[model samples]
Target: MSDALEKAEAAVREASTDTAAVQLAFAAMELAKAAQQQAQTVPQHHQCEHQHKPRRSAGEWLGIACAVCVGGVGIAFASLALAILGGTAAIVVLVLRSMWTDYQRKGR
Candidate 1:
């Protein structure tokens, strides 16, 4: 019997006027006792058992390294393309501005 169940039983005995209250208290005490017994019978354990994954093999590691290298090369190419595009745009803008200024001066 748990400490809480014992206390409740003692309290119920002291004030056992209401028959319904006494019955409810007795039912609760019984449940507590049943749970206590179940706990003792069953083994304690963590809620979640940790499952460890197997370590990567040499072949898997080599494949992963190759994938990383390919990804890095792709990123480098993309950056280089963007830089070229920006430089071309700047040159075009400067050339157009100069042509417009020369045309205006000739007109004046």
Candidate 2:
């Protein structure tokens, strides 16, 4: 009976140790699967394949050109007024026109 009990105890200990090892192996497999999934899901940066789109249509260009001509005339009148008023208004008008030209060039 004592020998039989010892054998049963040894068997239980072996089985418990085997269960622990199997659990650890399962955990390691889960970690490896997670790492593989993460590797597969990683995003890579690639060059953009998009093209530039123009902001204005043909009709828009015509309208913008007309507006610029009108604005130039208005600025000329304002400059004349500034000249008569005897202040820096003429300089301001010139600066504004310069900025407008720069803006138009950049838009193109």
Candidate 3:
């Protein structure tokens, strides 16, 4: 099916000398090997007839929002207590923002 293979076959047929036939055979083998390697290295992608995943439900979003709000309120009270006891509120905000950014990136 390959042009190189077709050309090599033609060359072999036309070759009068043993050396010419051997050289053509070697060329064809190399071409076949390269093609095989390419097939192995390249990932084969198949298209789906539909979407990969169903959309998230509204109830799921509401539940997630509720959990987040509860956790956030708890953290705010904890961080306030820590700040009152001479801890750094700025560091808490920085760490929480960094974690949220990482979570957003991973979700995408």
Candidate 4:
């Protein structure tokens, strides 16, 4: 536990007057709040400052174009072809997601 918490406990344990206990309790609360703020925060320089994620790469753009073309062609062929196209698009999207995640992990 924190030093402030230990002190708070000691204050509570040894209190002789209601006023003294209240003052100690308030001090303990402020300490707890300060500690919480410190623990929850990160340095501004350590955070992401970009307004948006970087643009997709050339290969990623190409993949998106192919997916869009497949979707467009599926519109002309109707039900069965559309379903196949949708499934293919789903698989491609999953593969791309895994690739992106791996790329990010490696970069980190």
Per-residue CA lDDT of model 3 for 12-42, tens digit only, reads 8777577887999999999999999987887
Top lDDT prediction, candidate number: 1
Candidate 1 deviates by what RMSD?
Answer: 14.6
Q: Which stretches in model 4 have alpha-carbon errors above 4 Å?
A: 1-77
**lDDT-superior candidate, 1 or 2:** 1
How far does residue 92 in candidate 2 sit from its true spot (Å)? Answer: 99
Rate residue 35 of model 1 by lDDT: 96
lDDT of 2 by residue, 1-108 (tens): 999999999999999999999999999999999999988887765536789797888999999999999999999999998788766767789899999999999999
Model 2, position 97: C-alpha lDDT score: 100
Question: How far off is residue 84 in model 3, in Å?
Answer: 1.9
- Sorted by TM-score, highest first, which candidate order results? 1, 2, 3, 4
Residue 26, candidate 2: alpha-carbon lDDT: 100
lDDT of all predictions, in order shown?
0.93, 0.92, 0.87, 0.90
**Model 4 clash pairs?**
none
Query: Would you list the rank order by lDDT, best first?
Result: 1, 2, 4, 3
lDDT of 4 by residue, 39-79 (tens): 77966778786698789999999999999999988876788
